[model samples]
Target: MIERLLGTPYERRLLGGGRFSGPTAWLIAIMMFVMLSVAAAGLALAGSARLVSEGVARRHMAQITDGRSTGAAAVAALRAAPGVVSVTPVPEAELRRTLERWLGPSARDPDAALPIPVLIDVELAPGAAVQPVAAALKRAVPQAELISNSGRLGPMLRAVNSLAWLSAAIVALVALATASAVVLATRSALAAHRATIEVMHGIGATDEQITRLFQRKIAVDALAGGLAGALAAGIALLLISAGSLASAGEWTGGRLLGTLDLTLLALLPFIGAALATVVARRTILHSLRASL
Candidate 1:
């Protein structure tokens, strides 16, 4: 297919003599860059969702509002309960440290320390019903409030998923824009060289040949732009990854790009180039048919 799309020497001499070089290449580059960057962002959002889902699966939190004695009883009850894997009580000092992040150093001062709820982290066995566990825990310790991790983050997860979908929509819009630009450019080039096209037709140059000529030029430009854009996108993503890595312990989730993600991003430029080539060929052929 690539060989057939290559511009013949005769074809170039016959119809490729335009004064304006056009901005197809640069246009394609900008489109590719935007598309790739948006795609990477979508991938990152998806990865975060997956990590959070995995991290929270079958996890539950029990908050005892009564006292430490109630927290101890809840932990003991959870440990002896069926389908419960383990239970750990959050230390008061650790709780104070977490509060310090929001309430400042005053949270750590004993005199000014706020009332802290006793939190027990619970890990349930697979397929355990949260309702049954909550009911049992409620009966065991009335002051305990059982909260499912997934339920707590459900809204946030949905929001992340929505943003990921929006990113995909943006990428699709950019691709459609790229194709539209190619179509307009091809038509303008055809219009600019109408006399040459007529002469080529008179001299036995078929529409297929002329179409291939335009395809070759547009394909080269698109490919060059796509590559440049892809390079820029890659550097940008690398910088983002570097920044994320520099934060080290801040992001306890997974990496931005997995192996599959890397492979797909790597192919984006080639895919964009091929799409532009196809659009250009179709536009040129349709215009030629209309004109002659």
Candidate 2:
């Protein structure tokens, strides 16, 4: 539509291709920037929640206080149990290394030699009942303790759910505010150009033509504002990532923003433009009809 309006003389006259009033462009830019930030935050938090959920859902662990031999027994029993997918006995030395990675240089301190329990990781088949599987393991290895993190999963799932709702609300509010901004701009332009529009009406120009001019103009302004907003959002995200670099690995499991995630976020500018165009056209149509 913008390309089609390039050679339209009257549309050009109406648009003027100059800066809109002071607050209009800034209003859009600020709104879009906040929207982008909220969107990115929601996405990142949701990703973290998903990681926690998947980590908990896909696996369970059994701790053996007796020794490796007892842990091995638990592993064998888990393998033979129905709905058991696979079991891996975690070596004490490997556990020590993992602790070391987390604790860093402090792990080498003499006080760091605290006893770590032997661990056996268990995976269940799809749609399997955890209680039955856990009971079977306990029966097979009477000394083994079944660790169920009902509390952990519950909180993570709830947080994910809450984030989803919050993100939706933020998106809805941003869209409403953006549409309102476009409508206000259209009304202002129409009020300022009433005489010109009336003359155009007398000369046989349809309301749709005038609406297109406003749509194209608003869309272009929104595109510019959206791009500015996106850039600001990008900078903020980068700064945050930089600040959290030391803990990013431990926090997000080393996979924070995948390519697909960033790709979706990058579409905000175009979406803003389209939204602005729709709002402007609708406002123009309604106003024109009311006047007629």
Candidate 3:
């Protein structure tokens, strides 16, 4: 049924290829490029956010203004606390170096008499409640200021999520635009071949035959354009990934494309072509039904 509907090699070309083919191919290519780029960005953003969120959820920080004894006691309490994984007290020298790197030479000067506090990093087991652990830490050292990463990361996570959603929206709009272009192109082809189509109908050509003639031509054009666009988008993405890898100097697991990302990207061209073919077939068939 499918083969018959699409016609065969012996079927004469009723909708002849014309000037629209080249421009239509180029237009689809551009749309595919934009769609793939936006989709890749959205995937990267979503992956990064999940990684960061997990890391933040499992970790908490404490700045202890009290003496070394208080810091040691706080670490002990956290290590023994429910849902606690591990605790590490950052060395004072390391803390001073970090401050100096960020705040300048003044932070390194012994004469400046900066009161560098004791910092303890606590890692909680998965599914731990931050508030309970924070309360336990406070009981151990009242002077210690407990900080939950979730609070600091909230706005940043929200922003990243918003951008990911925006990327999705852009991809959807590009798809809609591609479909619209295919529809208009199909309509133009139908208009251009109206007289020949009417004469075929007069000679006993059924509507299905006429529809198949247009569908086959439209499918070929769509397939050609889709493959071309996919190839161009693939090249652009490769160059982008190469530049990103060069700048990063090392592959951090989340920064590069994963298996799923590569698969989706690989399918972009076929998906675009399929979309164009489907849109064109529907538009042409509908127009034929109304006219004849």
Candidate 4:
């Protein structure tokens, strides 16, 4: 049944080629380029957004130990500090285990390491002033130094947000270009098949039938293009992931990399097919009406 449908004279007429031709190849190439470009841009935006959010979430000190005073006293001072929401005292053994989990077996050797500092996990009030709070902590706890989470995270968040905006702009441009390309391609295909369409009409073919034929052809072409484009984009992302993993090495702890979710990746082909079908059908119908 599939072979009969694909091999029919009507299918050839709809496709504007003999299964393989210059116009068909060109249309496929253009659609693939557009789809891949859009996909890449979307992935970039998602990665940037994730990086920014994670940076914000992790903007706090992880460990603080007091060598001059008892660990319990240090925890008390931190808890009483203004703008601090809560402070949880983590034991030395727990701290060592956490470090070992992130830094590997070498970090677990207690003899070679300095006495692990008592970790006080601080939760600050929302909209609290960070610099003033850090200054107050420094004065209150002589053995404690302010760990500047913002120093590492602030610049990274800014960079990621900027990149996200740039990627969004690129995606918009790609979408506009794709729409224009589809419109022009459909117009050309309609012009080339003008005589065939007129003959079909003369022989009593309905407008709906002709519209369906063109829509089917456009959908098939788009599906092929979308598959090719999505494959290319996935390979590109994999290469990027591999490079990042290689570069991160031992420092890969607590780092989150953004990736395209399966759902978004799966939706691309269907979106492409729908867009192509709607655009092709609209263009053909409008042209037919003009001819009438």
Predicted model with the maximum lDDT: 1
* Candidate 4: count of backbone clashes, pairs at least 3 residues apart or interchain: 0
Each model's lDDT: 0.83, 0.76, 0.78, 0.63
Local accuracy of candidate 1 as per-residue lDDT tens digits, 31-85: 9999999998898788788777766878999998747767767887888788988
The true-structure Cα RMSD of candidate 2 reads 5.4
lDDT of 3 by residue, 1-292 (tens): 8446445545634444442354677778778878888898887777667767777888889888746778878988788789988898998778778999888988877677788888888889988887878888889989887788777998998899899999999999999999999888778877888898889889998887777777766666666666776777778877877777444323323454568877997898888888887887788779988985
Residue 129, candidate 4: C-alpha displacement in angstroms: 12
Better of 3 and 4 by lDDT: 3
TM-score-sorted candidate list, best first:
3, 1, 2, 4
The true-versus-predicted C-alpha distance at residue 177 of model 2, in Å, is 1.5
Q: Which candidate wins on TM-score?
A: 3
RMSD of each: 3.6, 5.4, 3.3, 8.0
**Cα error of candidate 2 at position 168, Å:** 2.3
For model 4, where is the 10-residue window of minimal lDDT? 249-258
TM-score of each: 0.82, 0.74, 0.84, 0.64
For residues 87-121, could you state the per-residue lDDT of candidate 2 as single tens digits? 88876667777888887766545466566677888
Per-residue error for 249 in candidate 2, Å, reads: 5.2
Cα-based RMSD of candidate 3: 3.3
Model 4, 33: alpha-carbon shift in Å? 4.4
Candidate 1 wrongly placed segments (more than 4 Å): 1-5, 12-22, 82-85, 96-116, 125-136, 245-252
How far residue 37's Cα lies from its native spot in candidate 1, in Å, is 0.5
